[model samples]
Target chain A: MEHAATAPEPGPARVAELRRSRPRSPLLRFSALAGVALLVWAWAAGDIYESHLTAEQKGANLDRFLAKLTPAPVRESGDWSDFAPWAVRLLGEGRGAEAVLLTFALATAAAALSGVFALIFLPGAARNLANPDPLGIRGGRGGLAAAGWHAVSRCTRAFFVFTRSLPEYVLGFLLISVLGPDPWALVLALAVHNFGILGRLGAGVGENTPPGPARPVVAHGGGRLGAYLSALLPASFNRMVVYFFYRWETCVREATVLGMLGVVSLGYLITDAKSGRAFDQMVFFVLLGALIVLAGDLLSALVRRWLRYERT
Target chain B: MNGALQRCAGSRRATLLGIALAALLCGWLLGLDPRRLFADGTLGLAGEFFSAAFRPALSYEDPVPGAQPFLLAALRSLLDTLRFAVLAMAVAVPCGALLSFFASSAWWPDLRRHRALGLALRALHSTSRAAMAFARSIHELLWGLLFITAIGLSSEAAVIAVAIPYSGILAKIYSEMLEEHARDAQEALRSIGAGGLAAFAFGLLPRALPDIVSYTFYRLECALRTAAVFGFIGIETIGYRIRLASDEFHYREIWTYLYLLFALVALIEWWGAAIRRRLKT
Candidate 1:
């Protein structure tokens, strides 16, 4: 009791004192070193500091751009308009709503297509599922089947890596070239990238699923496919749903960006307004894009909440 | 119990049906026509693109008359892309860390005890949250375009454009992580009469640090991709070269640039994984 009364309270001050006395953690030291190295490399390689234009010219350019935010005088020669009616017209115009719908539609299609592809390829890419024990097979011919399955798994894994490594914007660019600036080009590009992501995630889920539940079924004369369908799929489906919703959120954002490629989406509207020098209209379109993303975010949140409750 | 089981099952079925219907509606709205997918010579064009992508122009000997070789140009653009992403992350991570301190509810637990302070803190929190949302809501590509218009085509514009939205995203994620993981520890510290910031620093930050670091690495990968996309707007990145090559029908050169971009992403991903493994240990 005496010792307890006499000892330090081990409160914030003590924590600070202890921290000050302790040597710097190796991780912290390593991170600092890495940060310094990165900064040095960035200094050498980044062009942000190396501008050909004089500072005054850059400052003037910034001022001019900032000036665009305010309404220009109503002249016959000018394209700018006052804020009130411009905003009213922006909301009244069905284009903004249509763009939101198009963005949603694109995201939904991409998610659906990617989900299908993920389901198809995930099994092959999962090592545990793809290369099940040969001894568990009914016949002695399991060796050849296992070898073939292993090859398929490797190929599927490679395909996922290849597709996912290429960003959707790059894919959109290539697809636009081939497909001639259609909505399908954006959809396909988004789908290809998402398919890779979802497929890899689903494969990870499959690889990590414990064999305990499925093993009994396999022992009871059920084929591996049957066991997988009955046990593995059900076990992983909830997690897959969670991942899908997360990816859907990202897809919504990507769909909006894809509009910059001349698609008739919110991004396209913003680009159009920018070119026309209608800053008000541009602001309106930007707000609408934000609204759509917010709504998508809200929906995802609600669905995730429901899923959590359902799981419990 | 039997009736309850049946009702639960019915609700589940209905939910599944609702989801299916929504998917169908969305698909219909998109005007997805399978027939048109391969029509109008798209297949041939896509085939050519794919074939050329597989066989990139790597030879330095076959240089175009006065132009730099494809490999050298691609490599340089690749470095530019890396630099852009790294510099942007450098700005974002620290800015986000600062913003997250204000944004996180757990960090301001004592606000309620003092009414005036509570109101001010609430306003600050809401304002910071709104600012982050606004920052992230605009896509990086749009931000890049806006920056280009604002400050001309300087690398500063590109870096700042990427940095703004990325910082917002990082701040939001960081706040959420702190809120989720630090609440209990923070409460304990508060009970011990620790100051808000001190409590967060001592109690919460360590618990949340792993997740924060992991998410940052993920965001860095994303930043790298965005940096490449900025190239499309003439940032002298790999995407710019890709666009130029594709426009000129130099598919081989496009592939070269793309392959380099892919390698960069792959390398980052590998590094991120290693860091995550270390964090786990």
Candidate 2:
């Protein structure tokens, strides 16, 4: 108690100095204020509560919906034994299995194609490679050559940004109309969006690479393309693969939903079930989609873990 | 050592080969046809769609006497989309924070110090993590469909649908960030007799706050996209307008809505980057 009483508190001068030393950024303040303002305005708009259904109607709808989710056979027989056969029939006769396979195929094809395209185009967006002074080589090209390289980099980046901004569903919606419901429409939609993401990610990986092995190729008077192929590509291959799997996981999720555009995937089946008011079938297909996503996530995680283990 | 390095390189090549083979197999299974890409009349439609990009609609292509102007309708839908996104984020952020708190193991007390409590906390952590995974397994669109089927497509249904998966995703990332940050400060707090949760709150949460905020902003951008997509199911966002325009073969009008969406996404992305930079400094 005597020692505690003798301990000096933080003096006013020290407290004032602490306040002065705190990190400050006007942009952050503005952003926080804007975010709050937006929230207030959104709440005041009251758009979220706009519904034609009365409370009673909504309650009834919910009750009916949940009741409908039980398998019809089980609901009638009151036996858990009926569920297995019903599920088996749904998987076999109802085209659910085919839809699942198609969803997986769509994701694989799109991700592979995007990975290929990204490899080809990402170098143009990579600052280290796109610069005239490639790999920081001394006395590199100047003036017009430098300007041309800069232009290519800028244009490539802009193109990636444009594609990345378009949501996959929006792209699929437009492509389906233009291409007339072909599977190519869905594949292309997924591919285009993912190409942008992969390109950007690949460019970042390339830029952040140590530039150790890659510099030797440049020093040996190799061209930018030569250096990229022989050194940077090999050095960053594992990292690129990791990003590919990450995007592929997302592509699987998107492909499941893309089928709602009416081509033929898990999403289409879910939508069809809903329109027919086969709530039981809808729930089954939704669960099936969830299973597919979980499987995809597991696969990607395993591959990423392997990659990490090998690298270390 | 040289032989081992060669073997490592060989395995890497084999992995690449395996991936390529898998892709080919998937392509074969899909039975993709090249002819369908060039199906009759697709070129004309594609040309028309591309051409419309340069001249987005300034007014209705086929004007109706009583209908509001084109720009005004686009503006309204844009605001609706933004409002829906904001509402969803409002629900998601706090829910995500709470979920992440339970999901993470970072705040757990020393097991030796409180054995029974530690076991309970461990159980809670696993349960929260499993719930997060299950919730995140389904896409938000499907969640929206489920909610709409159950509740009949109100704004609350849409917001909740978006919030569910977003919260799960945010929680997962937030927990990872919390775990990844250094625990020196937290340990110091604990050594001074601070409670586990208190130390985490004061010492660790602030260290992870900037990253968490940045990611939340990113999630808000995603929520905006999801909100637009929900317009397809009758939420009256920009996507609903795009659907309407496309049904009428109003390519120019569709482009207008698309450009508006793109502009909004671009603005939010820029704002997020600025905020992140500020936080870093």
Candidate 3:
């Protein structure tokens, strides 16, 4: 009865507290909009000014596009050249959109392709970790036996150190010369670099689950695979999802970079914008590329949220 | 222990077979008609480069000429890269920490409000987070490419463009750190007379500062490497300069330029870390 009385008394007070706690939504909106605006304005100023300079410096390429933007002869020739679509003339016809579309398409394709590659390449490694490896045994009767575990640990540690030390950029640079420039080359390169990251992340997930699970399975004389399936897989599934998203984000960036080598994609738009001397188009495309990545991350977050919290 | 030990023994044969096949493949690809390398007293071109590479390129008296231009160029570019890292950290760490207060559930007492606010905050966080992420994910090369076209080919655009994505990453990490460590303290502050923002500042900020600084330096080091990577868009940073020298067929100068960059990057990192340690003390 006292609990009920106290609850009724506090209910009105709690509602008042929320109103006080909430910041002025308008003020919050104003600040956020202003902040974003300020950054955009600053970036635009710098971006626009540089674009102008590049257009001027690059010479005749912009002449064709700029000329198209300028008013032509009064009596239009009715030829396809006489009348230009707004973005077409402004962006030098379809090239800008094409570049954007192409690169975005490539990134999407690469993500799917890599998933397939992972499914194929990872099973052995997964089994190796999940199942007991008689192959790892070093037969030594004395204290030398302890060294075996140490060696195994050292190898695992070294694998991580080597995998993460070099970013894919460096790897791409090294492989570019060795393999020569092929579209497939970049794909292989991206996959290899990403594989290192994925494997390390995967191993971490396997090792870091709660102890209760594996102990019970192992205590029952279950094999390594049994312990892993019973204990680790379920626990690590959450981490695996997050890691995949992170890798996908990295892959998107790599696909853009690979474009520099004439691999062709969205980065090509960036190159075209600069080369064609259309600074405005450059801004549009940069925003576009940024949006695509932003979307990917949002998707990842959505999945993570769904998995992380269960409905009471 | 027995099972674990047995596993190791089994992998050795596989490991040996893998090496043998790899060696065989290498020989096949390199035109390893072993008869030529073994029968003829010629060490071949690769062998020749390896042997020659071991010999030092310069003495105190005879300094390499092409080396300095490349090194200086790389040094200048690397400085820009380092600047990007520092500035990105500066921008991102605070923003990320600020956002985390809202993103986490510490501010809410009841289930209904928390769920609604949590969803909203998550959406906002993810979108902004995505912006920051994509900003970095699009390689600085792409960033450089667009910026060079739009903003012109200056080091400043390169730096800022590169920084945008990194800052996004930094913010994301910082938010996660805040979520993990400051949840309880933030809640305690919120339960009392403290406002959410106020509680976050007092409760979370102090604990997060050390980590922020440590991670900032870590990110700074990463940025340094990225700066070199930015050469693709013609930034003429250390990496770009090296590629240029190589194109000009100055192999010895390439090594020299690389060494200079290594020495400089190492020095800067050590100096920065020392300063941080001292500051912490």
What are the per-residue Cα lDDT tens digits for candidate 2 across A1-312?
999998657899878988998988888788879989999999898764468999999999999999998999999999989999999998889999999999999999889988999999999999999998888986366799999999999999877766776778988998889988888888889999899889989999999998999898888888789889988988888999999999999999889999999997899999999999999999999999999999999999999989978763
Which portions of model 1 miss their true places by more than 4 Å? A1-32, A46-85, A91-94, A133-155, A207-212, A221-224, B1-20, B60-62, B109-115, B182-195
In model 3, the runs with Cα more than 4 Å from the true position are: A1-145, A211-231, A309-312, B1-84, B87-139, B176-182, B195-198, B206-218, B234-236, B245-281
Question: Which candidate comes out best when scored by DockQ?
Answer: 2
**Pairwise lDDT winner, candidates 1 and 2:** 2
Candidates' RMSD to native:
5.0, 3.6, 12.7
Q: Give per-model TM-scores.
A: 0.85, 0.94, 0.58
Q: For candidate 3 chain A, which ten residues in a row score worst on lDDT?
A: A131-140
Docking level of model 1: medium
Q: What proportion of true contacts does candidate 1 retain?
A: 0.53
lDDT of 2 by residue, B31-88 (tens): 7777766766888899899899999999999999999999998999998999999999
Mark the regions of model 2 whose C-alpha exceeds 4 Å error after superposition.
Answer: A1-10
True contacts kept of each: 0.53, 0.68, 0.13
- lDDT tens readout by residue for model 1, B154-239: 88777888889899999999998887773787778889899887888888898888788878977887887788888787777788
TM-score (chain B) of candidate 3:
0.63
Local accuracy by lDDT, each model: 0.78, 0.89, 0.53
Docking class of 2: medium
